[model samples]
Target: MAILVLGLALWVGAHLFKRIAPGMRARMTERMGNGSKGIFAIALALSVVLMVISYQRAAFVNVYVPPSWTVHLVDLFMILAIALFGLGSSKSNLRGKLRHPQLSGFALWAGLHLTVNGDLASVVLFGTLFVWAFVEMAVINASEPRPTPYTGGSTVGTIRLLVISLVLYAIITAVHAWLGVWPFPG
Candidate 1:
């Protein structure tokens, strides 16, 4: 649990460093030049590894038992979450509609996980990430001006995005099932 918390803290700190301490981040970036991104990437990778390892080993101390019905909801909402996740990078028209679609998707992913996982470890892990995504959104929204909406994506692009999102979601479900957690309620 301690390691999990540490991992979560590292994840949050690495992400928020630039927003929380602009001067310090600037100084580091100035010194490291292009390598600064590598540094952050390494930190994020390490944090994820730590969190994954710790979470797998964590004892299942129940916090609350989610109703079985949420299983179906998780599947449905996850499709939306996955689509929102791809919106930022996809050629879909909705790409420009949201300033932080990726973060919004990440938060949605984390929050949705909580509906099915009620253990303390799951709460701490997903809950912290959920909050961090919102905090990140707030910080970025404050620092940047609202973006102009784009008007140029074709319906084909959106259809392509949906297809890709659905495929990725299917793959993700397969991975979870391989790990012994089937997402769909039997």
Candidate 2:
């Protein structure tokens, strides 16, 4: 639990640093030059490792039992979540529809996981991340100007996005199954 909490804090702090403390982030960037990106990447990766390890090891303390229907909903929405996650990089027409598709997808992912995972550890991990995504979005919106929506994306791009998302989603499901957490409810 200690490690999980620490990881969560680090993850949130690292993500919020640039938005919350521009001056400090600028100073660190100046000092490290190109290394700043690598440092941030390492920190983020370490946080993920810590969270995963600690979460798996955490004792199962039941929080609240979720309705069985939520499992089906989670499965369905997960496809949309996965598509939104890759929207930023894809040339999909829907890319311009959202200002923060990736973050939105991340929030969706966390929320979906929370629906099925009623354990204290799962709640803490996913809830913290879900809150962090919203906070990050708010901070970015406050600090940044309105974005120009992307345009000129074709139907081909949209098809590509859906295809890639489906492939990636399948892989993710397989990985979860291999890890002893089958995503689909039997």
Candidate 3:
């Protein structure tokens, strides 16, 4: 559990460094010269790996049990989360409307996961992330409002994003099952 917490701190801390301390992050990037992004990426990957191992090995203590019916909400939230994530990260018209779609997706993912998973570790992991995402979005929007009006988003783009999101969702759910937890149990 300690390791898991440490890993989470590292991963989320680095990712949110710019949001929290833009000057510090910028200074560090300049000091690192050309390898800054690469160095941070490697560190972030390592932190994520550590988190996975620590989380999987940690003991699960029951904190609260969410109703089983919330599993349906989890499924819905997970799919939309994935869709928004894909659209947000892609160079599509959707980005016009959802300036921070990826962060929004992550917030949704964490919030929805909390509905289904009531373990202390899950709460510690997902809950913090949920709060962090919202904070990041609010801070960013307040500082940097979207300049361009949304006009390019189209039905065709929406359809493509939907298909891609669905496919990714299927793959991710299968990976979850492979990891030994079937979210949508048969």
Between candidates 2 and 3, the one scoring higher on TM-score is: 2
RMSD of each: 1.0, 0.8, 1.8
Deviation (Å) of 132 in candidate 1 = 0.8
How many clashes does each candidate structure show, in the order listed? 0, 0, 0
lDDT of 2 by residue, 49-149 (tens): 99999999999999999988898999899999999999988888888999999999999999999999999999999999999999999999999998889
What is candidate 2's TM-score against the reference?
Answer: 0.98
Q: What local distance difference test score does each model get?
A: 0.93, 0.93, 0.83
Task: Indicate which candidate wins on TM-score.
Answer: 2
The total number of steric clashes, by the backbone 3 Å criterion, in model 2 comes to 0
Clashes of 1: 0
Better of 1 and 2 by TM-score: 2
TM-score of 3: 0.90
Tens digit of per-residue lDDT, candidate 1, span 60-165: 9999999999998999999999999989888887788888999999999999999999999999999999999999999988987878776678778999999999
